[model samples]
Target chain A: MKGMTIIVKTITRWVKLFIFLFGIYVTLTGHLSPGGGFAGGVILACSFILLTLAYGKEYALSRLSLKTAKSLDSIGALIFLLTALIGMWVTNVFFDNVLQKLFPGTDFMLYSSGFIPLYNIGICLKVGAPLFVTFIVMAAMRIRINDKGEREIIQEEEEE
Target chain B: MFITEIYLLVLLVFMIIAAIIAVEIKSLISSVISLGAVGVGMSISFLFLAAPDLAIVQIAVEVLLLIFLIRATLGREIVSEKGAVTIPLRLLSIFIVLVILGFGIIAFRNLPEFGKPVFSLVPEAPSNSYIQHGLKETGSANIITAVILDYRGYDTLGEATVLFTSLLGALVILRAKTKKNGTKVINHKETKARGGE
Candidate 1:
């Protein structure tokens, strides 16, 4: 698919950065605000999705390739696991708020929450990358049901 | 209190109308769009009910779901394989639905009053403790975040793992294929196996 019209492309170009920033804001201020990791991550994915819808699939892949997205997904999961493991090592209990024990940060501040923001960031990456990857994969696939009731899957040709 | 109830009534009515339209619409695309309207209505209702967190999640998820559904339906060759439903089958299904709805209404009546949780019956419930000490213990202003990431961290961890696994499964299942010698083969393995096909 060649994507939508020029008007959409122009609007998307203007709006994409703001959307990314908003997602980061939501994830970072999760402790002080309503939205958290999952919600913020979805917003982040939506930014890339807007880009894909406006500027075609090839442009999106060029910006964030499937391989890189897969790696980011793994890395995000690892970071979350590492945070939990570190907590266990520090407090002798799994998933404990070790930072709180070490140094209780002041309340309502951005950095105050003990490891919650870190978890949010990790989860943001974990959720965002996979969602974007899922969209890309789904968009690339062309599935049809033939008259004989057989399923046919066709992979879209890559732009040279 | 009276105004709030009126607002909620309006929102609920809107949602019900949208839901009916979603079900009865002949065009698949129109049906999907109406279903999205139902979701957005639900999100607005959540906002009115003092749950902005749920509202945000609902709207975001709704957008993604709408995109996916539209992608599946738009510009696609849709084949309706199933024949028209028999009268008896339709009547039986409608009866089953009515019975389920009746049971649901009964269950709803048995629920505790609004804003008073059944957990209140148990004074020593963990949710009670969470509310009492959530902010103080976790130093997070949002008690919900504190509970999810701190008090019940294991649950969040499990949820993340589940999401990770499911997405990974989807990617593996949808991995692209290439025709090699007039036979379809997964290109993923070949790329890694030969450093490039």
Candidate 2:
């Protein structure tokens, strides 16, 4: 499956970067703003989905393969879990705001929140990668016609 | 403020209409678009309700859901086999709706008016304490963010695990299982010729 059109391709090339940057900004600013981990993650996934729609599945897969997506998904969850455990180890309480020293001086700054922003980043990656992978897999589903004219659902797994 | 209330009322009416269309439309794509419109209306209502956080999240999620819905049904032609709905079933649904509506009105009347919570319920809930102490305790300016990440971090972790499990399950079910050596893989290759296809 090739892309949609040349015009769309050109426009997507210019616009996708900004969309991605906006997603990052939202994820980082979760503690201070309306957009947070889940919201930003959806935006990031949308950028990738937009790429898939404009440039086709092959191109998007080339940029971020299924294996890489699976790894990122697990890594995100692991980081979130590890963050909680680290808090528990330090303060003897799970998910405690352990870093009290980093809290006061930089109030309202990017790194103001002790642990919330880190959690936000983890949630963003966890949500974004899996959402995009889900779309890619759904799009890869095909209806194949055999020599006997029997129709079957042919889901070709992505080769690493 | 009065003008905003009128606008909100109009938006609510449109939302109801869009929801009905979403449920009733024959074409899946049209129904999806109608649902998307309803989502947009809901986001706008959230904004008017002074919840920018909800408004942003609602619109972003709505966009992703629409994209998924459109992609899922894009190439597939709908096979329409109309089944006649029994009169009793339809009547039962209508009866249920009427009963729910009656109860809703009674509940609405019993409730405190907008912006005024019945203090008799919780007796000065932690909402006020959260906003006041959230900054010092959690060091986050956003009250909602503080509450979710610090106060209720365990719940967020549970939600994340749920998402991870859902994706893991979908991948496991969808991917084909392959066998090695001798006979063959358990779920590999439909035909010998098109194994790679």
Candidate 3:
């Protein structure tokens, strides 16, 4: 696919960075704000989706390849699991806030929440990468109508 | 009636109209757009209901859904077939919907009014303690975040696992299984060659 017109491309180039930053901000500040990991992850995915919509699938895939996305997805889940296991090892309780015991930071600060922000980051990666992959996979199967009015399938080149 | 209530009512009416339009529209693109309108209206309603987190998620997910639906429907010819539902079936479905709506309204009437906590404030409730001690325990200013990530961390972990599993399942189903000899099992090249002309 060639992608949309120049207007969309230009606007996407300008706006996509801010959207990515906002997603990061949301993930980082999940403990202090309304949006947590899930929401932030979705927003991050949207930025990539926006890029795909504007610059075509090839460019988007170049930015974040299937191999990298799959790895990030697994790494995210692993991180979350490791954090929980570490908490259990430290405090003998699953998912306990072990950092809270050591530091016990004050409320409303950026780093006050023990492991919540870490969880947020993990969930964000877990969600964002898979969602982008899903979109890419779904978008690969292209169906178009020919002049004879017959439904035809245009298959994307398979990635190795 | 409060101004917010009026806004909510208006949004609800708009959502209903959009939903009906989505159902009745013949064009797939138009139907998907109308459905997206309904979703946007719903997210707005969530904001009016003071759930910013839900509103954010709803709007983002709605946008993604719209994109996927539109992509699927774009350039596809709708093979017009006979209506699956007869008049009697339509009437029966309408009657069932009305009954459900009536029961829902009755239940709503029995429940506590807006902006009032009924059962959540009870001493035995987990949310009650979370609300009371969330900041002190988790040191997170946002109680919802604290409750979700700290108090209910196990649930969050389970939810993450569920997402991972679903993603894995989708990938597994969609992926083409290839033979070891580098020959394609799901032959897309043949379809592409046929469609190329």
Candidate 4:
């Protein structure tokens, strides 16, 4: 689990925040831009993966624990479902654009897209957190045998 | 547009070269990098085709793919520098290529000219409507986004559910512990140190 060279670590530290911000921007402005939820979420996950690659799992996990990722994953799914349910309650449609009425904001503006951005945000969280957690869980595997002649899996060490 | 065509032709050439390297290269890391180059070339081609959304998504997906692949190959010895291609395997690949080429030749001759659609025969394509009224109806500047989030929302929901299910499945599989000897005990010190509860 030990990280790469110091050069990579320094470069990652410098660029991780910018990558995160770019992912957020892509997710939020999805309606106005090319990148939507899935693309932006993948970028978001890449940023976290980059940090983990540069600084090792232990360092990155300290910042974002597996517990936090699991909760965020569920929260994202719940929010997405809730948004759709609200659509059903109001319009009797499963996934209708509920904001087609009252405040049909102007096109081309950032705030114009009603539920699109909300859905994008929800999807970004759902996609990104789980993806990162999958990487962490997969990478953390350390198999060993104990005194009772039983094979068990444990987390790998931080150091090389 | 003529110059754009030339650029596209060059990009396509590079993409082919990248694809070949991605397959033929001995070093797994080099192969992955070459595959990413193919992705970049495809993204550029998407840009030339006026599909910025596809270009962005393609690039982001390429990055993620590269990361996961590199991670997967970190300690693996799957790729061998000395591994030689067998004659039968090579013959099979050549046969497949010839078949594809034959199909492409027939298809190209039968199909209409580029930039001309046969969609006029079918019912009004949703894409035409999306381009015409996507922004006005959805208030989203990006028609692709509008279509994905508003018009074809059910498909997107299904896709999201698929991703969610895959993640959930991975979680379950990763967390599954084999109950060995009725008392499975991994290194207690490491478990107490930083294991996810």
Candidate 5:
């Protein structure tokens, strides 16, 4: 039984790693491909779900706490909004690409597109964190009724 | 006019069916699913009307809203018994559907040609050329990104603000308030009874 548990844990770890990497790939290639922040975020959230399923909620929460995830989500959202507001400062319109003055040339370079990549990253973080939080919180809230008809909230005890 | 009329008719039919399903479904989950379907159908209609931006926004918003709704509704006891669909209810739904469909068809008649490129009143600067150049220059292949972040960055920012507002709303709604007041506040008598058992 112990050996089986170890094997299961190993497999779950690999699955979570694969999902996380796939999410990165999707977000990076978003500009050149069909996928974008929405798809990438969903993929990233799926990795957390995999971790939660394989190792249990406690294990998952240990790695990525709900509080930390919520903070990251808020920060990402703020970054995205700030990027747009900065555009107004530069060009009198919100989100106008005034950063082109900082970059010399334009034509298929990473820095050439101004703040688009940054925007993508912001959206990726924003979408990924909330999605993971939604799944984890809901799963953690599950109540199990035992054979004795006693209801038990199946989660770790709150830490001091 | 011809193709537009045909497509409009098809969309009208879809809208009617979606409404009926949404109204008649016994299960709350199924009704929510139908509501999502209705949103998707409307987004498609928006796309048909040459509002790609609106369509994309509509689809994204609908998807997020559906996720939130599903999470909110999970584990709740669904009222299993559905009362009979009465005559007045049926007639009222039908009447509402007809009125909306008629209004939609009338609106469709006033729309511009589906394929015609309407000119913007703004200065005809090098927006198109800049977009073309962006494809080769930005190392990004997405035309939408080129237009959104490069040519029209301000609009993208507004879109981001909309997303931020939604995230804030979700946080407010889902935030855990007080800590679990010590695990169901066990009653002493009940605890003793259980101990005796």
Candidate 6:
């Protein structure tokens, strides 16, 4: 039984790794493709969902706690807000082009662009963390009905 | 017909079918799934209309809303299984459908042709510098990104807030709050507190 659980956990972990990598690829190519922060975030959330489904809510939550997810969400939002505010100070408008001084003379290199990548990273974290958190909370709260028609909260089993 | 037009027509038909299913389905879960199909159809239509951002957001919100709604409605099953349509209700639905169809026909006629360049009537338009700078400065090759993140930064901020608010609301609604009595009300408490309590 333990060996079976380990195999299941390994498969789930690999699936999650694939999803995470795919999400990163989508986010990086967002500027050129149909995918963006939102798509990437959803893809990332799917990984968490997959893990939860494979190993149950307790296993998933042990790896990513609600507190950590909430903190990441708050930090992402703060970073996004601060980036816009910094732009306001430099160019007199929120989210203005403040990175022009960093790379002078129409440098169109990928890294040359100012806060777009930063914004993408913030959005990725913002969308991914909350989405996963919601999934975890929902899955944890799910009432399992047994053959005897009893509603059991699975999370409480973890404490036992 | 061109491929784009064909795709649009197919999407339109699918949307109509999904809407019909959403109305006709007796089960709430089936209805919600049908509604999701409708949302996907609409998002495809948005993509056909050259609004990918709206499509992405629409799809995301629809999925999130569907999950949230399903979770909320899980315990409260719809009791009725008759699936009967009353006469007065049917007539009212028909009346509403006719009104909506009439408006839709009129709106369809008013829309511009596909692939035609939108002509600006006003002379003093904002400079395209913002868009150009967005492409150059944002490192994002997608023009939509430039428009969303740079040209209309404040609007994006508002969108982010909406996303945040929806998540917060979902969390508040779905979170398992401990009872005031301090007794953990979930199952399997014996094994859980065996060591400590």
Mark the regions of model 1 whose C-alpha exceeds 4 Å error after superposition.
A144-153, A156-160, B1-106, B177-197
List ranges where model 5 is wrong by over 4 Å: A1-8, A101-106, A143-160, B1-139, B147-197
Model 2 residue B15 lDDT? 99
**RMSD of candidates 1 onward, in order:** 14.4, 14.1, 13.5, 14.1, 11.4, 12.1
Error of 3 at B29 (Å): 34
Model 5 lDDT tens row, B8-98: 6798788789879989989877888888888888898888888898999999999998887776767665547779999999999999999
Model 1 pairs in collision = none
Predicted complex 4: DockQ = 0.37
Candidate 3 lDDT by residue in tens digits, A71-105: 99999999899998988998899998899778888
lDDT (tens digit, per residue) of candidate 6 on A80-140: 8999898888778778758754653333345545676667667777889889987776655
Candidate 4 lDDT, B82-141, residue by residue in tens: 778999989999999999999999998988778877664455976677778887888899
TM-score of each: 0.65, 0.66, 0.66, 0.66, 0.54, 0.60
| lDDT accuracy of residue B28 in candidate 6 | 87
Evaluate model 5 with DockQ and give the value: 0.33
User: Which ten residues in a row are the worst by lDDT in model 1 chain A?
Assistant: A151-160
**Which pairs, if any, clash in model 3?**
none
Please identify model 6 stretches exceeding 4 Å from their true place: A1-13, A101-108, A142-154, A157-160, B1-102, B117-139, B173-184, B187-197
Ranking by DockQ: 4, 3, 6, 5, 1, 2
For each candidate, report its DockQ versus the true two-chain complex. Answer: 0.30, 0.30, 0.35, 0.37, 0.33, 0.35
Regions of model 4 farther than 4 Å from truth: A142-151, A156-160, B1-100, B116-123, B180-185, B188-197
lDDT of 5 by residue, A36-82 (tens): 66678789888887777777777788888888888878887787778
Top of the candidates by lDDT: 3
In terms of lDDT, which candidate is stronger, 2 or 5? Answer: 2
Taking candidate 3, what TM-score does its chain B reach relative to the real chain B?
A: 0.46
Q: List the residue pairs that clash in candidate 6.
A: A31-B142, A159-B192, A160-B191, A160-B192
**Each prediction's interface RMSD?**
4.7, 5.0, 4.6, 3.0, 6.4, 4.2
Report how far residue B119 has shifted in candidate 5, in Å. 13
